[model samples]
Target: MPPTPATAIAVDDLVVDRGGQPVLRSVSTRIAAGSVTGLLGPSGSGKTTFIRAVVGTQKVRSGTVEVLGHPAGSKPLRSRVAYVTQDASIYRDLSVKANVAYFAALYGRSRSEAMAAIERVGMGDHAHNLAGNLSGGQKTRTSLACALVIEPEVLVLDEPTVGLDPVIREELWDQFRALAKQGATLLVSSHVMDEADRCDRLLLLREGRFIADDTPADLRAATGTANLEAAFLHLIRELEKAN
Candidate 1:
C-alpha cells in the first residue's frame, strides 16, 4: 500500500464567519492517514462549514488549513483530497458511468480507471442508467465512485449517508471501512451517532469546537452513557454550561 499520509489534513485556529456571525471559531484538528475520523455535530453547528473550509471551497477568516502535508490554497495539493458533499455532485442528464467519467477526466484519469471506480462502487451494472433515473442511494454511490476515481489520499465526506435506506447506508459504511483499510484517510461529518461509531476515532463537535475526542467505547465509558448519542448530548450540555 502507498505509505499513509503523515498528516492528511490539519487545521489550526481555523475561524470562519458568515454574515457577520462566526460559524467556526478557533477550530483545530488533525486527521491522519488510514484512519476514519468522524466529526459529529448537530445541524447548524458548523459541521458543513468546517468541511467546506477544509476542502478549500470556503475561505477562513483566520488561521490556516494544511492538506496532504502542504498548506491550503494550492490547487495541486487540493487535487490530492476528495471532497464528497451531501448533494451528489452529478449531472442528472448524464448516465451513471458518464458522471464518473466526466469527473475522472477533470482529474486526467483514463477510461479504464474510471470504469474501475464504477466497479468499486458496485455500480458497473448500472453504468448506462441515466443519473436522474437512479435511486437516491445509487446517486450517492455514483458520487463516491467519482471521488475514488481520483485516487485521493484523503476523503472528506459531509453527510455522505444522508437520505439513504438502511441497507444501502450499511453497504456504504462497509465500503468506507474498506477504503480506510486500503490506506485512505477519511474525515466524515455526520449527525447520526450510529454512523459516527463506525469511525476509528470520534471528534464530538458542538457549536464548532471539539468537546470530546476519543474512541466511541472510551467516550461512552467516560460519560457513563448508554451510547454515543447519549454521551454526546451529555458532553454538549456540559460544554454549554461551562461556557
Candidate 2:
C-alpha cells in the first residue's frame, strides 16, 4: 500500500448534449496526477465530448468537471491546463518556430522554452519550415510544441498521433511518458486500440457511456483477451448481453 496518487482531474455524473441529442451520459472518473490516461473508443463514441468537458470547452447538461483542483475551464486554471484538438490549432502561414514562439508569448513564456518544446516533439529540424509546407504529422507535432511551451500541469490531447508514422508515434509516446515523469498529467484520446497499452490507465467508452475504467493489464485479464482490441470487443459483447 503505497500512497494513492493525487487526483489531477475529477468528473462526477457528467452529462452532455449536442444538437438535441445526448452525447455523454452520466460519465464519471478520476485521473491521477502525473500519469498518462487514455480515452479509448470508436469514432462518434463521445470520446471527444468527454475530453471537451474535461478541458472546460464542452457545454455540459449536468454534473461537474474539476481540473487541477479548480473547476474545469476556470480562469485560474487557464494557464495550468493545455489542450490540443484533433485538428491542428496552428498558424499554417507561420514557421514551426514562429507558431511555438507565438503561443509561448501568449503564456508569457520565453523563446528558449518554445524551442525546448519543439525539440521535445521531435520537430526541431523543421522549426524554420513553414507549417503549411509540412506534412500532416509535422503539423500535429507543431501544434503539440505550442501546447508544451506553457509547461502545463495538465495536458489534454485529442488523437495526437493519428497521422504520424510508427517511428514518430513511438517518439511522441516516449515524450508523453517523459512529461508524466516530470509531474504533468496527460489525458490523451485515441481510437487506435493498440495505443491502449501505452497508457497507465484507460477509460473505455462507447455510445456516450463508459464501459471500463482500469489499467490496461487489468482490462485484458478481466476480459481474458490477448490484447486491448479483443478486450474492447469482449466488453461490448458482454454489454450487449446485459442490455
Candidate 3:
C-alpha cells in the first residue's frame, strides 16, 4: 500500500470565542501536506477568525491547532509558515521592490527571488513604483510577493485576490497550483464559490462550522448540484430542513 499523506495542519475540536460569543464550534479537520485547500465562506462567517487560530494569533476557548506536527505559532514553525493577511501591509514610502526586498533580507533571501516573486505576481512593471502610488490590487500583489519570497513550506492566505482583475486572478491561481506542486501546503480563503473548482480540497464554512469538507467533485456528486454555488445552496436547504 502506498504511504499515507502527512497532515500539514490538524485542528481538533477547535472552539474559538470572541467578545464572549462562540466563533468556532468543535471544528475538526485535517489539511494534507503539499496540497491546496480552499476555505470558503461569506463575510462574518468566521473565516478570518479560523485563519487566525491556525496561525496561532487568536486565542481559542477550547481545542488545539497543530501545524507541521508542532503546536501552531511555535517558534520553529515561524520560519516554515507564511501568512498573507487580507489587509495588504507595505510601507507607503517604499517602492514595491524595496518592500519585498526588505522582507527577503529578513530571511536572507536573495534579490533574485524577490524579483521572481514580483514577476510571479505580475507586478514586475510596477516594481519601481512607490507602494503609495499603487492601486489596491497592486498593493495586494506586493503583499503576496513578500510572502512568496520566503518560500515557506506552508502558506495561509486570506482573500488574496479580492481586488485583482480576472486575468490577474487566474494567473495567481495558477501560481498557487505551482506552489502546491512544489510541495507547499496552501490554505486560501475566498467567498467566491466559483473558485472552488481551482482547489484540490474545499472546506465550506458557515457560522463558524464546516458545512462540507470534501473535493469539489465529491461535493457536487453528494449534493447532486451542477456547480459549487448550487451545491452550497442545496446543502443549506438540507441543513434548514434538518433543523
Candidate 4:
C-alpha cells in the first residue's frame, strides 16, 4: 500500500453529561487532513463540551472520540492534536515569547526554533510584552501561537475570534486558511454566522445534538435561504415544531 488515508478526527455517537444532564447525545462527525470544519452554534449549545471531549479533557459518557486516528486521551494522539480553548490560556506575568516557549517545552520543541512559531502568528513584535498587557486580539494570537508551536496535525479551537475586532478576525481567518493549505485539519467553534460561512462544512448544534451538517452554501441552497443565520434559524424552528 502506498499510504493509508489519515483521519484527523472522528467522533461517533459521543454522549457527555454536564451537571447530571446530557450535553452531547450521540453526536458524531469526522475531520480529515487539509480541511476546515466549523462547529457553529450559540453559547450553551454544547459546542465547548464537544470540543473538550474530543481533546480528552471531558470524559465521554458513551460512544467514541478519536483524535489523530487514536482514541481520545491517548498519549501518542495527544501529541499530534492541539486544542485552543475559548479562554486564551496564557500566563499574564510571562512575556509573549516566553509563554510560547513554555508551551513548546512541554511539547519538547527546541528553544532555538520556538520563536519561529511565535513569528508565524505575527506576535514577534510583542514578544517581550507581558501577556496580560496585550490586547484581546493579541492574546488570542498568542494563545494560537502556543497551540501551534508543536505543529499539530489536528487543530481544534473553541471560539478563537470571540473578542477580536473585525480587522483582526479577518486576519485570523486568513491564517486559518493558510493552515488548511498546509494540510492541517481545523475544527473551530463559533457563534458568528459570517465566520461559519468561511468553513468547508458546518456542524450546527443545539441542545447537545447536531442539527445540520453541510457546506454553508449547500445549507442555504437546501433551505432556500440567502445566509447561514437565517438558515440556522429556519432549521431550529423546524426542529422545534417537530417535537
Candidate 5:
C-alpha cells in the first residue's frame, strides 16, 4: 500500500462569524503537503475570510483549525506560515528591496535571502525603485517577495493575480507551482473561474460554503462539461437545487 499522504493544513468543522453574520460555517478540508490548492469563489463568498482563518488572523466562532499539527494561531506556526493579501503590505516610501528586507528582518532572514526572493518574483529590475512608484502588479510582486524571504512551509495568498496582465499572472502562477515543488504548501484564493485550471486541487465556495472540492479535470468530468467554468456553473446549479 502507498504511504498515507502528509497533511499540511487540516480544518475540522471550522465556523466563523463577523458583524453577527456567519462568514464560514462548519467548513472542513485538508490541504496536502507540497501541493497548490485554490479556493475559488465570488467576491463575497468567504474566500478572504476563509484564508484569514487558515492564517490564524481571524477570530473564529467555534471549531478547530490546525496547521502542521498545531492549532491555528499557535505561536509555533507564526514563522512557518505566510499570508499575502490582496492589498500589498509594503512601505510606499521605501524601495522594493528595502520593503522586502524589512519583512525578512522580522523573520530573522538575511539581506541576501531577501534579494534572492526579490529576484525569484521577477522584481529584481525594480528593486531600487520606491514601492509607491511601481505599478500595481510590481507592488504585488514585491509583497510576494517579502513573504517568500521567510521560506514559509505554508503560503496563503489571497487573489495574488487578480489584476495582473496575463503574462504576469502566468508568471505568478508559475512561481506558485515552483514553491509547491520545493515542498511548500500553498493556498491561493481567487474569485475568477479562469484561474481554476491552474490548481492541483480546488475548493469551490459559494455563500460561505463549499460547492465542490475536486481536481479541475475531475470537476469537469463529474459535471460532464469540457470547460472548468461550465462545470462550476453546473455545480452551483446543483447546489442551489439542493438548497
Candidate 6:
C-alpha cells in the first residue's frame, strides 16, 4: 500500500457567517504537504473566507481547522505559515530589495536571505527599483519575493495572477512548482479554470460549499470533458439537477 501523504492542513465541518449571512457551510477538506493545491471558485464562493479560516483569521461559526499539527492561527504556527492577499501589502516607496529585507527581518531572517528570495522570485533584476515604479506584474513578483523571505512551510496566496500577462503568469506558476518540489505546501486560490491544471489537487467550490476535491485529471475524466472549465460547468449542472 502507498504511504499516506502528510497533511499540511485539515478543515472539518467549517462554517462561517459574515454579517449574519452564511458564507461557508460545513466545508471540509485536507491539503497535502509538499503539493500545490488550487482553491477554485467564482466570486462570493467562500474561497477567501475558507482561506482565512485555515490561516486562523476568519471567525468560525462551527468546526475545526488544523495547520501543521497545531490549531489554525496558533502562535506556534506564526512563522510556519505565510499568507499573501490580492492587494499585495507592499511598501510602494521602498525599493524591492529594501521591502524584502524588511519583511525578512520581521521574521528574524537576514539580508542575504532576503536577496536570495528576491532572486528566487525572478525579481533580482529589479531589486533596486521602487515598487511604485514597477509594472503590475513586477509588483506582484515583489510581493511573492517578500513572502518567500519567510521560508514558511505553507503559503496561501489569493488571486496572485489575476491581471498578469501570459508570460509573467507562466513564470510565476513555474516558481510555485519549484517551491512545492522543495517540500513547501502551497494553497493558491483562483477563479480561472485554466490555472486548475497547474495544481496537483483541486478543491472545486460553489455557493460556499465544495463540489469536488480531486486531481485535475480525475476531475476531467469524471466529467468527460476536455478541459477544467467544461468539467466545472458539467459538475455545476449535475448539482443543479440533483437539487
Q: Whose lDDT is greatest here?
A: 2
What ranges in model 2 sit over 4 Å off? 1-5
Across 100-184, the per-residue lDDT of candidate 3 in tens digits comes to: 9999998899999999999989899999999999999999999999999999999999999997899999999999999999999
- Compared with the true structure, what per-residue lDDT tens digits does model 1 show for residues 103-213? 999989988899999998788899999999998878988999889899887898989888888987887788889989999888898988889779988987777677887
Locate the minimum summed-lDDT window of 10 residues in model 4.
1-10
Residue-level lDDT of model 6, residues 184-240, one tens digit each, is 999999999889999999999899999999999999999999999999999999999
Instruction: Identify the runs in model 3 with alpha carbons over 4 angstroms from their true place.
Output: 1-5
Model 1 quality (TM-score): 0.92
Show the colliding residue pairs in model 2: none
lDDT value for candidate 2? 0.93
Clashing residue pair totals per candidate (backbone < 3 A)? 0, 0, 0, 0, 0, 0
Ranking by lDDT: 2, 3, 6, 5, 4, 1
What does the lDDT read for residue 30 in candidate 5? 84
lDDT (Cα, 0-100) at 133 in candidate 3: 99
Candidate 5 lDDT by residue in tens digits, 194-222: 88888999999888888888999999999
Q: Which wins on TM-score, candidate 2 or candidate 4?
A: 2
Minimum summed lDDT over a 10-residue window in model 5 is located at 1-10
Encode model 2's per-residue lDDT on 36-141: one tens digit a residue.
9999999999998998999999999999898877889999999999999999999999999999999999999999999999998989899999999999989999
The alpha-carbon root-mean-square deviation between model 6 and the true structure, to one decimal in Å, is 2.4
* Candidate 1 weakest ten by summed lDDT: 1-10
Candidate 1 C-alpha error for residue 102, in Å: 1.2
